[model samples]
Target: MNDPAIAVDGLTKQFRGGTRALDGLSLRVSRGGIYALLGPNGAGKTTLIRILATLLRPDGGTALVAGHDVVAEAGRVRQLIGLAGQFAAVDDHLTGRENITMIGRLYGLTRRAATSRAAEILTRIGLDTAADRQVKTYSGGMRRRIDLAASLIGRPQVLFLDEPTTGVDPASRHDLWSLVRDLAADGTTVLLTTQYLDEADQLADRIAVIDHGRLLTEGTATELKDRTGAAVVELDLPPHQLDAAMTALQPLAPRRDRDRILLPAPDGPLTLRHAMGLLDQADLTPTDIALHGPTLDDVFLALTRHNTSRSARSTA
Candidate 1:
């Protein structure tokens, strides 16, 4: 295979007092694609990002960004990567254009080059109108866009975005998504870690789920959903009639929790039709019914739930 844009092998990190933040995590990201890492808080996503960004040292294992070892070649690796952290990192005292220009200068651009690049980036990020406004006067979303613009100053080969949309408004988040897509289309590799499942579903070419410092699974959204090998038929009925609905649908082996009954709908709408017929036979009328395939949320919940259950059993 061609060289991957990023590679990790047996990466491990342990904090003080024996908190294993990452354990033997390994993965490869192809060039020019968006790879998303999904995990609950404390699942080592940030740790991995920091390591790859050359901001943190790993206790064991190796990570290479743009073919430079993150540990041994930290300086070279840093030159090839851009990082937009979980929070905006712009200086509140500086104007938007000044912030980006400063970053360009830091990357060794000449004074004239930095100023020109700053103007280009400000326009690109749709912040040209706010170019002279102090960053403190910008809204949260505007600040985020400025921060992202700063990261692109060096034209990095690999970009790491750690929850880049976390407090952003819906409109700004949409803009950021478009920016990421444009970057990938231009052959920049992007690694994103986000709390939003829908964001991953919409933007990621591939996604990896992590828990307890280990990888649970990784694949495209459709592939991950298909691995579940089942669609769901959800029935919403009156609370008083839920039991009746579940009983009537028992032949379909429905699972009930609270007011909803979910059954495996292997035959898609045919299964929903059959379920409706059973409910009608029992004189039960569903307030709502729908048939849908497994979603990324379903895949995440199932994988994490299984991991938690296995951990419990092992401890017991």
Candidate 2:
């Protein structure tokens, strides 16, 4: 489709206690790939998700899903989107198949169709053998997968995943990532909200970094990383010399990570030489030093330094 799958314009939502969950936030998500809303806790990531999913109303502005207005055409939007929240919404007492089938039926599918869809999705999500098993018997990873399966029962065009891999182990998180990639490859547009830096870096085709209910930046992972600089200089100095070195390199805006001090080398080699000069001025001898490409962690550190987070009354 030529139009974006999801669109928001000057969205504003305030709570009863005068807290701003969303402050004139606007975003455009294209169809058929993963678009991530990246931020720390209470950054309004969940608030945006809830508004786009039509679970909550936006106090101002407008939104559209698959080209339909979220407020005026909520019913139409609901028909085209599927949502999987932070926690698994499956019944412990029910079998995985039953849970999925029930959701399909609620979407207005006939018993036979719902059953068939459940079976198809169960296998698609690698839960076929566990289909008949009670959800209570499933592992944390398996339960998350089952909840995802239920969301897919209707084969929605646009899927909303709110922190999909919040607590899954590394192995399960990897599996979920692969599944999400495959779904996008098959033409499902996924709008993911997450606080996990690696999750957004590894999965999103593009990322929107939001803080305090507003956009800080938006781009491909590499593009966002480049915002920090072309490269980063990491220095390992003698433990005793750290204090003097910090004061000496104040102009570089250095931040310490464990035993290393990180500085953005925007001019690459030139900035690197400057860092060494600054250290030399303080008579500080470094144990080691190197320059490397910017990472999401580096980008995040740069952003948070200038844009601090504030507490929201309630959004999630």
Candidate 3:
């Protein structure tokens, strides 16, 4: 990653109905990296993407995409960026090649140039064999890839993906991930927004967690996980023993996820040992117990919980 490809500062947007979508949110994204934005529904992830893609204007503040002001030089910014929304945007009646070629023509390419470019991109995106088939016949993953291919017609310097994999199957999701990595490796700056924690953990070189249209935190996966806790002591037991085990470990302030009890191990091995000792003293025969590093899910939960609690207190 090098240089700020996207710069957003003091950005704010409010709807006519008095809904504040963005609250002075600001973040900078570097060139040639897979940057991910993680947040819940209505967190303003889409709003931010729309602003950067020149689809919507921010009510206040400044945003620069590809070194061009999003509001002032909208046309220039549009030329340097590509965007895919939450769902696939394609004509079901057209073939994959036709779709890409059409987008190319819209980008000012000649008919021949558009056709040649579309043929080349179809191969690159693994749709060459199915290029002639109507888009309605393609699978969900193929539709997504085609939509992404459409975005690449102009060779955009900045690509915005807002929930690109939503409602996609596991296999399709993996395919999309590989394409994103390849794009970044080829010097394309990608800005991805997804609710899938693993998507952010595996693909993003850096991640920004936003809430209420404001940035809560931004860093690498490891950095964000470190803010939660050092390790997790997970205990697995039978249904009957769950209550006893949790009650016995009450002093540790354990939390339950499904059938397992999760205890924050800030002291790492020391906490693990303490937990084991407590279980032993209580004569609880557990099915299994393990220690592992905190996961992205843990980090997300911890951050959101903290923010919600703070917001509640502020209101109180």
Provide TM-scores for the models: 0.88, 0.89, 0.92
Model 2 C-alpha lDDT versus the unseen true structure? 0.88
lDDT of each: 0.90, 0.88, 0.89
lDDT of 2 by residue, 24-52 (tens): 99889999999998887878888898888
Tell me the deviation in Å of residue 287 in model 3: 1.5
Give the best candidate by TM-score.
Answer: 3
Could you give the candidate ranking by TM-score, starting with the highest? 3, 2, 1
Residue 311, model 3: lDDT of 60
Model 1 spans with C-alpha error above 4 angstroms: 238-284, 312-316
The TM-score measured for candidate 3 stands at 0.92
Candidate numbers, best lDDT first, in rank order: 1, 3, 2
Instruction: Tell me the tens digit of each residue's lDDT in model 1 across 134-237.
Output: 99999988878888898899999999999989899999999999989999999999999999999999999999999877898999999999998789999999
Residue 105, model 3: lDDT of 91
Scanning candidate 2 in windows of ten residues, the lowest lDDT window is 307-316
